[model samples]
Target: MSTATLNVRTGPGLSYPVLTQVHRNQTFSIVESKKDWYRISTDKGEGWVADWLVTRESTGSLNETGQQGTVSTNGLRLRKGPGTSEPVVTILNKGDIVSISETSGSWLSVQSGNAGGWVHKDYIDLGAHSSASASPSKNKEAKQGVITAGTLNVRKSPSLNSPVAGAVHRGNPVSITGSVTGWYEIQFGKSKAWISDNYVELSSTPVEVPATSSEFTGKITVNSLNVRSEPSLNGNIAGKVSKGEKYPILSERNNWFEIKLKSGKSGWIAGWFVQKTVAGEQKKSTSSTQPAGEKVTILHNGTNIRSSADVQSNVVKRADSGETFSVTGKQGNWYEIKLKDGSTAYVAGWIVSIRTGSGSESSPSRNTSGGIRNKVITIDPGHGGRDSGTIGTRGTLEKLLTMKTAQLLADKLKSAGAEVIITRKNDEYVSLPSRVSLSHYYDSDAFISIHFDSIYDSSVAGHTTYYYRNYQKDLAYDVHESLADRLPSRDRGVRTGDYHVIRENKQAAILLELGFLSNPAEEANVTSHHYQDLAATAIYHGLNDYFSN
Candidate 1:
């Protein structure tokens, strides 16, 4: 479709109610069209926007206008213009939602759902139109079968020792037919397979235990850690839970434990570094009862295998074998697997596959959630403690200032029910690596570094959002525009920076200099409580703009 710019209109050269403003590089959806006007629906709501004001940079939403309601995810954009040459946007949050209208080559007509604006898809998911559905729903039919015992091989192929495919959880099911030595033949529906007889517990009738609740399954950080009761260090140890272990989460009480393991084993696991996995995430295979020998191939590169999924401190290796590994456990594709060396590894979802497996591992790529999409954001407060970033004229330490701003942003995000992470809570020097590490470590949706601007040239004034990556440009633009509109400072405009913090960072990364500290007037205004809150509000809205679109 041909791209257009949307102007929220009141009269010629005038606009009111504003409903919401779509800034440069933000995206939106075109629900309908009329002469010189486009009826647009954003994360905000549906409204009539001027076609002149709407630019090709504006993106549409996931809900396509066509029937069958094909969802479009590739609409998020980081843009210079509606054109590809525009310096790419960067630092896109993981779950930033966009409204896609049409596309050409690499350019996508888009807008942020929350903060309305036009942006290009240079650095975002440029969803291509498809006539077919993405995939069938996983819950359509829950197949029932018997469990085959032993070290069941869920191979990509129906073979044995075929690179030792994944194992079946202790009580899952399978359709047993015959046996080959210690291995038993099973029917995995369209395919038949063999699995070891050591690990499974077989039952004919489908035992109707209370269906697994859609509950949080908290994590265990250590490669092999034990679950225990009571908060005290000397509490009673319940059982050992492995890394990436999804312990059925009970409720949390202070620093203590509360969990439910397999087979109704309920107790507490320590609350440090362990977080419950979100529900609907622990989706069991259709053949949960069948220990089929299914296999998977590495779909992306740099898939990390760890001693455990707990900490990155123990990375075993970057994967090889484009190896067909079995899926022992899957919680959002951060699968738990027994490595070729009998170790464990955490493979990101995008890097591997269970069917038609053929792909390379070790390449840098990002994974998007299949459904129930939510935004993932990482907020970094620049400098802290002794490393008081740039000092302001009024003696306000940049670190202190940004920390307060960061806190405001964090609170706003949390209140909105979004997962928010602040790099530092106290005064302490945080290495740049650590900052980037935190974002990459979590496979964050987006990485935003908060800071105030300073320069030897005191005349360099106003606020500017710096982005090194193309995908982050719209984010910078939306945020910077929000700040300019909310605060009294002149818009320094979003610009490109080669700052190490933005450059080296892998995820969508942006650095904001919230007005120049060297300018007494701007500095004075920024230091005010109102301005601080204003900045926070702007950032929040900018984020909303990016994700809501």
Candidate 2:
């Protein structure tokens, strides 16, 4: 079932031609699958569909498919979905023959006699046969490319070494999926071939606007927000604005807001610091967009409103002694404030006297400051919806913890002027491939996957950062150092691992194992609010250093 209106392509990857269109709630039986796409028996006939747009369910045991596999493990359980947490539909024994349908990371959708579900690919032996299925729907936006070569061979896959099935001449038109680096899809039957676009003329021309999108109006949440020329941190600074200012959201790409600037220009702002007001409900909304909580009092006239939780951050404006501002959020020893012009700035916690709604006054001691500005960062909160992730000794759920961490990290990053994109905003299962695809689509400056680790041994506890490619090791080391410093757990250091999210990602990616949920004492400490804030602050500083260096 498609969760939203979806596109059915001729082959697995985005480079393929669109066969037809399907709307939400439209059901299609699985004919076969390759990679992250499924060959579904739709009403229009069998076409490839990206698995991310549809929800999977066990529809009884399926028949044989193109690719076949043998169960390697004895008594391997077949769950309804890819993850281990998904309910088991049935079980299989060693050497049991199963038809491989689709794949989601390390898991494969398979079928056998009276049994249909997902099993770990590690427990399945799929021979040397190359499954002719490949999916590319994660990059659903429209694109077109013109062939440059007078004669070019279209290979069966993205690789140049793959066998050529056909050819296309100059002046032939092709749909660009941007799924592969050098290849443009001009798909054929079972042997879907791709053409090289090394010198081809390409343009990003969107064919359709997703039906699920709605009108949005955004109110500035930060003190002074940086508007970028493009929907990324790398985009040149086009303009600036202050808090409380409202603008019609011209467009939204990923989590960046494209708004009409005051100078009769258009620019994109990080959506993290913008209060979204959907069309219609704008009038009944509250005036405050910041999370209303503690209020701070200025002791001396000419006090400064620094841009971030740092003393060195440029003074945006001056404040008179005894002036008060709501403490929207706290970062170590800094109090985040929204100025009259709607500029967000940080006042040192040690200097300002804090007053909460309950009338209690206090001063903070801890001071923290490193912030990375003008960078596009993607935060992936691992596991969601049906995937609960690792369950800790104290019943600490890794999914919820990662979400909390990602939120705090995003807030701090936004305050520091970086555009932040989150893979999962709520409790929803996002496939591993989709997460990496988003990073690629956004051309993110950095990608961080947040997760809490676990093991059978309850006594071991620590925070470890994992990287795949050598290019990402520096990021892992930088982030892990800060996490190990701020977190109240052991320092496991940085190491290379084969995690799918980081391994498959083309961008600078790293995965953080913030702490061990298997350890009882560590779980209690890691679940605390203070620890999470410190962790976020530390990571923020780490990125600051990484980008600066």
Indicate the worst ten consecutive residues by lDDT in candidate 2. 205-214
Per-residue CA lDDT of model 1 for 1-549, tens digit only, reads 212334454332223456555555565666666544677676767766655444534323332221111223333335535554554332134444444545555445443321222353444443442223321111122233333222234542222312222234333455565543224555432344445433333343553222356434565656766666665445688777787766666676654457777868776665654643333223444344223554556543444565543222377776653576765653321456656766556655434555422433232111222210245678888899779989875677888888878887775454344567778888888898888888888877677888888776553567888998898887778777767766556787888999877899888779988878865445766776546666776787677666655
* Count of residue pairs whose backbone atoms collide, per candidate: 97, 10
- How close is each model in CA RMSD to the real structure? 25.1, 23.0
Task: Show model 1 residue runs off by greater than 4 Å.
Answer: 1-374
TM-score of 2: 0.38
What lDDT is reached at residue 166 by model 2? 43
lDDT of 2 by residue, 1-549 (tens): 424568899999767999999888777787776756889887778899877567766544433345667777765777878788986554576766666765667878775642467898888876543363523222332466544455565655554434344454443444554444335564332223466544344433322111223355577867899999998777999889899897767887856889986677889998766765433233411122223466887764566688865544688877776899976654444667778877677876644566767777664311222235568999999999899999987678899999999998887676455779999999999999999999999999899999999987665667888999988988888887767655546798888899999999999999988888876556766897656766777787677667767
Model 2 spans > 4 angstroms off: 1-331, 335-371
**TM-scores of the candidates in the order shown:** 0.33, 0.38
RMSD of 2: 23.0
